[model samples]
Target: MKKRVLDVGNCGPDHSSIKRFLAKHFDCEVLQADGADDALAALRGGHIDLVLVNRKLDMDYSDGVEVIRQIKAAADVAHAPTMLITNYDEHHEAAMKIGALRGFGKLDLAKPATVEQLQPILGSAD
Candidate 1:
């Protein structure tokens, strides 16, 4: 079975573009989550191999860091590696501090950087 990725964010143009890119390259199912609560609920549903957090989530939760923090705190999905997607490269430290494994710049999605960063997280560790 293809690995499943819980993509937490709003359905903006950029977000939809990234989703398409992910679907094209990665052999995984991308599950969309609109907010922190929604993301947590999906995590609870099981079979998620990765948790991709959006830096500017539209819901009241505001930031991806909060979403990452909550995912790490959850007993059922804490083991699922979380990554932050952002336009700013500087957010890497902030994401790490919030317990995200790492952060990837959204502009890098179409480039080699996205694959380089995500391959391992998507179960390419071997």
Candidate 2:
């Protein structure tokens, strides 16, 4: 079965770009959620192998950290590995404190280098 990655964000095309990129290279399905409620709902409804969170949410850009925390706290979905994606490099450290394996700043992700950077992290399902 293909692994599923839950992506929590609504940053317009950037969100779609990441989703498409992950689907193409990670050998996984990238599900999307625009806010905490939607994310939590998706989390409960599916078998997710990974969780990618944007540093800022559509509801409140600064809520991404808190959202990840909530995702980690949920008993049903907490086991999936999680990470934060933010333009601010600083959130990488913060994401770790909240239970993410690692974080990717949006700045780094925007570059073509992201494919190489994420290969090890996402670990191809193949």
lDDT of 2: 0.76
- In model 2, where do residues sit more than 4 Å from their true spots? 110-113
* True lDDT of residue 11, candidate 2: 73
State the local distance difference test value for candidate 1.
Answer: 0.78
Tens-digit lDDT track of model 1 for 1-126: 688888888557766777787777777887889988888888887778888888888665488887888888887778888888887767778888867887677678778667777887674522
| Residue 29 miss distance in model 1 (angstroms) | 1.1
For each candidate in turn, the TM-score is 0.87, 0.82
Which 10 consecutive residues of model 1 have the lowest summed lDDT?
117-126
Worst 10 residues of 2 by lDDT: 117-126
Q: Which stretches of candidate 1 lie over 4 Å from their true place?
A: 123-126
Candidate 2, residues 1-126, lDDT tens digits: the string is 567888887577877787777777777777888877888898888777777888878656666888888888888878778888876767878878878877666566545566666666567522
lDDT of each: 0.78, 0.76
